[model samples]
Target: MTEKQPQARVMIVDDQPMVLEKLRLVLGAHSDIVLHVASRAEEAVEAARSFRPTVILQDLIMPGIDGYELLARYREAEELAHVPVVILSAHDDAVAKERCFLLGANDYLVKLPETIELVARIRYHSGACISRTERDQAFHLLMVSQRELAAANVLLAKLNGIDELTGVGNRRSFDAAMAAEWSRAQRQSKPLSLVMCDIDLFKRYNDAFGHVAGDFCIKRIAAALTEQLRRPSDKLSRYGGEEFAIILPDTDQAGALLVAEGCRMRVEGLAQGESSSGLRSPVTMSFGVASLSPTRDSDMTAMVEAADAALFEAKRSGRNAVRHAMEMRAGQRLNA
Candidate 1:
């Protein structure tokens, strides 16, 4: 099926009333063209900007601004640049034609050409202008779509990294962060610390209270653990159910121990009230602190293992205590 095209807009600019009337009469015969007339150059510029004509018919000699200056103005304007301007002049001088071309006129014609020739030129230039406008609109829409897609991708990445229930970094995010921090510490020869924290008797707590209350308890403990670290480089993640991990970038054993102890004290301070199920007490968490001057040869999993082993010791030594990986190792060596 053939699609119907919209009528092309034609603007005639001339100071002479007779010339304007003639052009208007010629264009009025065609139903596919809309005619707009301006008797002054300033009025022409204003009309072109507002009307957004597909083609412009401009007179070379006019009051206030001549054809050459008006043509220059159209060429300079971003919105008017795509519309073709055909100059109408009484004198068909070679120098005038060359000057008009240099000023960006699309075509130069003596006063008025034959009706058929004028219509053909107007149709050709108007069609070209329409094609250019369509292409520009399509390109702009594509750019907007690309920007929206990029924003959606960023939001997806954030949602993937976050734990939905606790609003903390999930296990996948923790692994990525740990690998990156490990490489950074190795490159700078700085100490990096990791703390594995578990709620003491969390299974018992969950068994005594409902899972709903257990969930609330974990969220509160996570917030308390997050509050212990002061450095922007430090990160905390929900390692698994009832267990959390802290990344202490550039922090040594002493600093890590201080942060771990702070988290322990904070969790112990959380208010507890008696429930209908059973008698409730304040929640306490155990911490396992491990710091290492990371080297390129060291395995990342070994650090996690050390932290986990320290955590086991903390649990063994009558729960709710903080244990250092190095201290555990030293004690083990002495016993051996």
Candidate 2:
């Protein structure tokens, strides 16, 4: 969608109604301008408050609260101070113009001047005012954009193990999270658990549905798995093609098993379309869980290997079952 351009707001302060009308008629042809008319200095100040003009054209000779006083008030106002004000009067004396300039009148113009000269001055002053406004706006926008970009970079850095296709954390992210959590667990002496999950018959499913469908299936499963981990310390990531890993900080074997079951159930409920071969069922995942206390001398590599082995056993036994690593190594002595 195209954005709308902003128009410049201008206020003309003069006691004479005829002069105000003339000024409007001269500048009205410029669609980018919004002209405000004020007949008194007090009225001009009120108009300035409401209109928030970028430029003010004020008459020097007024009945009360003359242009000089109005300019002083405008300078005192924090929001109105930056706005440029030009003095307009019938007195074309150099002394009067210089006094007005010293008192903060941006420029001085004689009344009933040539139309071309009037338009030229207005355009020139307005252009400078608009340029400054645009510079301030652009600086603010640049700051905002820089902040957003910094946030995005932080997110990207935290997303280890993310799958490039689906924008999910990849295996590397999962491993780093596990290592950090393990250290924390060792310090607090809390339980830590890991879950390794694989898509059932993913190779066959991919053969029947094409790689595109396979990718879709993986993304859906990854999203579902991530959704299951709502806790701040829980970590989920794509382990590899058609496989994912989950880290459950301060979770026992039973807790990990429940999380794995929930993820499995959610993936099975996705109701994806049929494969190209039209024989395979909708997507489903199998999980293997391992839990232990991470000690000072523990080896995370062995624990992850044990979880991976359990996942292989689950696949060997049945496609959609969850297996515990301790059960698989019941006859063998395993450390860490």
Candidate 3:
């Protein structure tokens, strides 16, 4: 099927009332073209801007800002730049046509061109202008869609790293962070600390209370543990159910022990009261602390296993104590 062309908007700029009326009367007979006439050079460009003309018919010798200057103004306007301008002058001088072309005129014609030719030029230019406008709008929409997609991908990646229940970094995120921190510590020869923690008697607590209350307890304990470390380099993650691991970059054994003890106290303070009785449920946690001056030869697994072994000792000695893996090794060496 053939597509119909949109209406052409033609604007005539001339100081002569007769010329303005003549162009208007001739062009007005065509139903497809809408006409606007400006008799002063001062207002012609502004009028065209507001009317949004598809084709401009400009006279070269008008008063106050000559037609050449008016043409320059229209060409400078971003909104009017794509609209084609046709110069209508009385003289057919080559120099005058060259000046108009240099000032960005699309066409030059002797005044009072044949009615058939003028309308044909206007329709042709208008159709091209409309097509360019549509193309620009489509390109702008495409750029916007690409930006929105990029932003959504960033948000999805962040969400994937976060634990939904505790609002802490999940196990996958912890592994990545541990590797990066380990490399940094090895490069700098700085001490790095790991603190592994488990909620004491958490199974018993969940058995006594409902699973929903247990989840709530876990979230509260996580927040308390997060508050213990003041350094921005420290990170906390949900390593397993009711088990959390802390990564302390550039921290020694003493600092790690202090942080673990602080976490233990804060969680113990979160003792929630039962509804049936005025007694609070015991909310103590056990901690296993390990620190190392990391080397390139060593990997994260050694540190993790050391912390896990210490955590087992803490659970074995009593549910609420803190155990240090390095300290236990020194004691064993002395006894041996």
Candidate 4:
């Protein structure tokens, strides 16, 4: 079955009572038209704002605000600007027709138009107005959708750089942070320190408990390491399996080592707590601290290599200790 179309709204503005009555009689026969009448042009403007007519029929001659001036006003108003306006006049003069067209009238008609012609004009203009309104609403919705999509992209970018398991910065975030901090330190001639942390005998712990327990252990250790660093410039990230990294901006070897020692102690204390699985082997961590006064020519990779070397020495010297990069290098030369 075909659907019935909605009723078209029509507004009439005329100072003469006879003209308004004629328009009502002509429009009353059409069941698809809804008519609104206003005796004054001022009332027409207010009615247009509230009633939102699809088409308007206005008499050319009216006292205190003629139809020509009212047509210009309607064209200026944002609400009624798009509604098709038809000018109605008793005299069919060329000058009056030309003047009405210049003032933005959509159509011209006699004082008492034929019923069929009036109904046809109203239907065509009202259909055109409805199409324009639909297009405007669709464009607005498209713009809103684009804005929401852009916001979602930004949120996805942030989540992409985060570690899902540890709830900390991942390796990607770490690399980005390192590059920015290294550049800042080089420019300001400031010291930058790195700490490499590894869980002591993590494989053994996983073998004793399950992988689920191992995950819990890692998360707890990550939290403890985070709590040990107080400054905003200190950043921690999960480097790899059972390993974490800390970046300390504007920090020397002494300061970095102190922070690393506190982190080691915090993890050790957590390990001493009773476990549900009765696997209460003291979980300890070893830390390697390296500090460098960055220069323009220095590479950030060299600092990471030095920290890795210190981590090797810490593991070799039994677990649960902090090793400095300079001390590790000196001992390595002596051994060599």
Candidate 5:
């Protein structure tokens, strides 16, 4: 369905009763227009306030106040400043037209002309005024819509790097965070730790149940891991399928071990399904913790590699356990 156009309010001020009636008859049936009539200048001001007209048609000669005085009063009102005024005068002299223009008259019409001409002039000027008002409103709405669209784009950009299923940072976000935090830790001479967690025998679990159940299991474990990271600087993300990573700022080897153990116990308590892996009786996680005081020349790739080596050792020795990178490096030399 098509929408109807908005109506414009118009006020007519004339001392003659016949002239006011004629104007109403001419403009009343036009689309989206309302006509208001006043016999005196004082009544016209009051009608303008009440009707809030977009345009005012005023008579030059009046009893109480002349058209010039009425125009001055209308201009002084802040609320009525934008309403356009057209002067109707019996004197068509050039001096009178110039004086009316200086007094803020938008247009002038002489009564000696044919009724058709007067009506046509009134319709033309009023329509133009209403059109200008609508254009201004539309421009303002466009500006507001543009601002909201810009804000939406920023939010969409942030969501692109996040994991939808787990509500945690994804692999890309994890890498970016590691690179930024590594530089800051080196500058402050603080220890940085990383914990790599793997769900024990996850492939067997998925085979027994279905992939849907496996997805649910991963999400639950991610939530449990996030609860253990209460510090503002602690960061966690989904590294890959059935695996997660945590970045602990200013944490030493001892602190990293404690955090990893906390996550391991929480996942064990869930016990969503049976594990086929012979090492662990139920569904659980194995964690590898790595701590280092990074220097300006430290590489993030090396830190992640050390953590992954520790994780492999945890799985090989026994499932549902925690291993430290420093201990694994020491054991390697002893075996040699």
Candidate 6:
């Protein structure tokens, strides 16, 4: 089925009674056109706004405030800014027509135009104005949608790197951070530290307490370890089921060992807090510390392996001790 086009709304503004009556009779004869008349230039803007005419038929010369002022006023009004204006003047002066065009008239015609030509011009301008308005609204909506989509993509990227259960960095986040920090430290000739810690006897704890309590214990331990790292440069991430890693940039071996011991003590204190919550078993963490100032010969794998070896030693010696990766050579072993 063919859709019917919308009716054209035409507003006529002229000072002469004869001209107003003539335009009313000519436009009112058409069934597809809605007509409104304003005899005074001062009231044209207000009348056009209320009527919301698609095409304004305006006279160039009027009694009080001239058509030039009225045309400028219509262009200034935001609601009437895009509505087409056709200047119909008695004087066919080129200078006057140019003045009307500069004042933002869309078209100009001398006195009594042919009925067919007048109606065609009105309908054509009316359709063009409506199309431009719809096009602008659609462009505005598209811009809003694109901005919203960009924001959503940023949020999704952030959420993808986060650990769901503990609200901390996941292993993927840790890997990316380690690569970036390692490169930065090597370039700046600064020391980078890694602290790897695991909950001691986690399987036994899970057997004694249900899996739900086990998850709760892991969350509490993660929070405690987070509290021990004071600087914003330090990052904590869940590297495994019961294991977590901390990255400390621009820190020496001595500083890294202290941080590991602090985390150990923090986790040990979790037992007392758990007691209030009805869990009886004590919780302790074994920590491995490794720190190095990267040289051209040093690699990321070497740093990770050193920390992993130290962690194995901590687990071997007893579950609750903090072992420095170079403690055998540096004599900086810390046990609790």
lDDT of 5 by residue, 46-148 (tens): 7788888877888999998988889988888876776888888888879988888887788887864566675566666667777877887898899888988
Best-fitting candidate, measured by TM-score?
Answer: 1
Across 1-336, the per-residue lDDT of candidate 6 in tens digits comes to 876666899999988899889888888998889998888888899999899999999888888999899989998999999899999999889998889889899999997799899999999999998888889999999999999999999988778777777877899989999998889988998989999899999999999988998998888888888889898979999998999999999999899999999899877877665566344588889998888877666768767777877898899998799887862222232232
Which tens-of-lDDT digit does each residue in 1-336 have in candidate 3? Answer: 877669998888988888888898999999889988888888887899899998999899977899789888987999998789999999999999999999999999998899999889888888888888889999999999999999999878778888889988899989999999989988998988899999999988888987888988888888888888798889999998999999999999999999999998877767654343221386889999888877755657868888888899899998788888853232131111
Reference-based TM-score, model 5: 0.66
Locate the minimum summed-lDDT window of 10 residues in model 4. Answer: 327-336
- Stretches off by above 4 angstroms in model 6 are 1-54, 58-79, 87-105, 108-112, 205-209, 270-282, 327-336
On TM-score, who's better, 2 or 3? 3
Among these predicted structures, which one has the highest lDDT? 6
Off by over 4 Å in 1: 1-7, 29-32, 39-42, 64-69, 72-78, 93-104, 165-167, 183-190, 199-224, 230-232, 265-284, 293-299, 315-320, 326-336
TM agreement with the true structure for every prediction: 0.75, 0.61, 0.72, 0.65, 0.66, 0.72
Q: What lDDT score is found at residue 77 in candidate 6?
A: 99
Off by over 4 Å in 2: 1-61, 64-69, 72-80, 84-145, 158-161, 269-280, 327-336
Off by over 4 Å in 4: 1-132, 273-281, 327-336
Report the lDDT of model 5 for residue 208. Answer: 79
lDDT of each: 0.86, 0.80, 0.86, 0.85, 0.81, 0.86
lDDT digits (tens) for residues 1-336 of candidate 1: 876656789999988988888888888999989998888798777889999999999899888988889998998898998689988899989999999999898998897899999988899889899999999999999999999999999988988888777888999889999999999988998988999999999988899998988988888788778788798889899999999999999999999999999888877766543343222557888988888877756767878888888899999998889998863232131121
Model 4: how far residue 302 lies from native, Å: 1.1
What is the lDDT, from 0 to 100, of the residue 167 in candidate 5? 88
Model 2, TM vs. native: 0.61
Candidate 6 TM-score, true structure as reference: 0.72
